[model samples]
Target chain A: MKDRPLILVTNDDGITAPGLRALIEVMNELGDVFVVAPDSPQSGTGHAITSNATIYCTAITIDEGDQIEYSSSGTPVDCVKLAVNEILNRKPDICVSGINHGSNSSINVIYSGTMSAAVEAGIEGIPAIGFSLLDYDWEANFEATKKYVKKITQKVLDHGLPEGVVLNVNFPKLKEKDIKGIRICRQAKAYWEEDFDKRTNPNGKQYYWLSGKFVNKDKGQDTDEWALANGYVSLVPVMFDLTAHHAIQKLNSLGFNEK
Target chain B: MKDRPLILVTNDDGITAPGLRALIEVMNELGDVFVVAPDSPQSGTGHAITSNATIYCTAITIDEGDQIEYSSSGTPVDCVKLAVNEILNRKPDICVSGINHGSNSSINVIYSGTMSAAVEAGIEGIPAIGFSLLDYDWEANFEATKKYVKKITQKVLDHGLPEGVVLNVNFPKLKEKDIKGIRICRQAKAYWEEDFDKRTNPNGKQYYWLSGKFVNKDKGQDTDEWALANGYVSLVPVMFDLTAHHAIQKLNSLGFNEK
Candidate 1:
């Protein structure tokens, strides 16, 4: 028999999250699975690493499986770091984060702990993908995601991703048949319109709750937002290189170097 | 004074950091300045926002100046959100974040709260820039940065940045005369080789201190890494669009849509 691909599974929703459990089951069918995930929920952590503090990890078995699991008191990105540098004896063939309980589409990826974990794995030169369901409920059905996730993971292992790139796969909240297949799309231009709910505490100290409406102004059919809104699973090939290469010429034209 | 252009200033090192005070002093020369910064340091928070809890902001006077400052109990990105949505009476002509206490030259931008603040402002459709010095000390002399900061900020105010773009400027640790001007460069390919210091805590539990050595493998002379190493201030125009556009066609060819 051909050797199974060694797959590292992780999530930002903590180890016991149903989304992560669903991912683990899917990954188990495809490879030798090992999980190193955050011990607590770490949503919206972005690409934060544990720099200013110490991290602690402990082994746990959430299910009877061939997979070994370790839960860490760190952010999702830190989990990737610990897994690669401390836990894994050898580099895994692939890493998959999330099956996140909420959308990580469009501009949401910038604030996503799920995507950040995948980005960390990508930074370490591993083929990685972050999977998120559009549904936010903890009990959201993930059966529709398995087939698509497997196909994408298999394709990644088959073809390999471009340098500095990782797959950000987000599924619509729909039945398997209702999911109108996958769309390779660009990140949509969208932003959160923050509304701070200012309130006075019992001690008379004021505070504000961060709440927002996601505003998607781009009407481009080729955008992830368009795909997700139209019931298609969106797969945006995200890159870690944040440089605006086109702006270099414009900045150079400003005579910054002449000084 | 023809209504000195309104400028918003902020930093990840908190309101009291000398670096921010230096930036505020610089902005005061060219504009009517408003400051909204974290009450405590939020250095490596990345693009994190205060979604899980309430944020608090209080007005404070750090120095005698025409500029007004508010200290927020939130991440740098939260400061930007609150500033744009609640604090600023009008949309500032430009937003500037940080005279960050350390280099945000290459991959450091991914982990920087300073750059994240600027990026948050850029996302809100304001022209923005993040400035950093190579020195990590709180008392690092920032006199060398004032001229360049003014020049760059003026240039940005003169010619607005392209949509979705922001400036990430980093200075080498050197005297004003030792600085070799500025270079518009691309973000260098670099990463941290993490050295986790695993230790047994007093309670007999294992813990780790996150520390790392930055490794720059890219030899491109046009990279930010090269410019900084060569004593030149590096200016990398950063974009919030994380899409790997080049990979879209490759992904499409995989029959993702046909399935």
Candidate 2:
């Protein structure tokens, strides 16, 4: 008989988040689970790694389950590093992050701790997936996402993901039956327009809270934004190579190489 | 009379870093400069933005220069956002982040706060560039880099970067005369292998400090790593879009789309 696959789980919404709990339940049915995630919500933390600071990772039990879990006072990227190097006995067969509280579609992936965990895993040669719900509420239901999540995990374990790519899977806020099939998509061209809320503190000093409106101008039907907007689960294959290869020839032609 | 170009300067190595001061001196000759950077070092913070926390941006004078400066209690990405949304009278003509104390080439870009600032500015539709020297010393000689910096900045001003692209310029730790001409290149495939140092405190609790060894296996001569190795300044055009478009077709063929 084949031994159960070792599955690693994590998230940006902390260990106690319902989203994490829901993911834990689904992952428990799949393999021998090991979870190490943030001790507090680390949303919008991006690909940050803690430096020159001491990180604390302690074993914890949130609820009775088959998974052995630990919580770390570190960023999502930190958690993945800790998991791969120090926590587990061996590198896991697969790693999954989130069931994040909100969407990480389009341009959100750049500023996402949830996706950062998955990307960190991918860099370490692990096939990884990051899942998100379109709803922002902390108590948002993740029931509809479980079946799709299970399906995708099976497919990944069945045939490993392409090298240097990780999955950015986002589900629309719908019931299990109401959800449409998944669509393979590309990241939509989008940006946030920052609108700072400047206020005077008790000391009569000004401080600003960052707030922004998501502006998606890409109308392409093949984009993640369009897929999620209509009804399908959006799956974007993301890569970390930021090189704009197409511009290299153009740059060479500009003759900046000359003194 | 024609007005000078507005230049926004920032870094991940803190507001008072010598590299930043050197960059300020170079930028002063070209245009009016606004310097908004982290009050403390924010290296490796990536694209993180402050949320649900008050950020302080204070006006300050580091030295007698025409460049206006502010120190922010935020990450590099925050500095760029605040500069664009609240501080500036108009959008900056160009945003240049860092003559960083260390390299952000290859996989390091994913963990770099310096490049994050440039990426954030690029997201806001500003022409942006991030510069780094191979040297990590606090007092590294930036003298050799000044002329090349001037030349590149002039070229960028004369011929704008391609749409959705920004430059990542990394100089080798060589004398000015020894430096070979610039080479437009692609990012090399590389990753860090974490080597966390575990320690026990007086409280009998174990903690870790993150450290790592950079490993590069890609032998492409057209890569940034190769360019830097050959005593040449490597110029890589970077884009913020994370989509792996080529892998989308292969993913679609996997048949996960079917219910």
Q: Which one wins on lDDT?
A: 2
DockQ of predicted model 2? 0.89
For residues A1-259, could you state the per-residue lDDT of candidate 1 as single tens digits? Answer: 1388889999898999999999999888889998999998889999887788889999999998778899999999989999888888888889999999999999999999999999989999999999999989989999999999988898888888988999999999989989888989999999999888989999999888998899999999999999998999999999999999988887788887555
Docking class of 1: high
- Stretch of 10 with least lDDT, candidate 2 chain A: A1-10
Candidate 1 stretches with Cα past 4 Å from truth are B257-259
Clashing pairs in 1: none
C-alpha TM-scores of all predictions: 0.98, 0.98
How many clashes show up in model 1?
0
Candidate 2's C-alpha lDDT? 0.93
TM-score of candidate 1 chain B vs. the reference? 0.98
Best candidate, TM-score-wise? 2
The digit string of per-residue lDDT tens for model 1 on B1-259 reads 4578989999999999989999999999999999999999888899998788889999998899889999999999999999999878789899999999999989899999999999999999999999999999988999999999999999999889988899999999999999999999999999998878999999999998888899999999999999999999999999989999998888888886544
* Model 2 residue B60 CA deviation in Å: 0.7
User: For model 2, what is the alpha-carbon lDDT of residue A233?
Assistant: 96
Leading candidate by DockQ: 2
Per-prediction DockQ scores?
0.82, 0.89
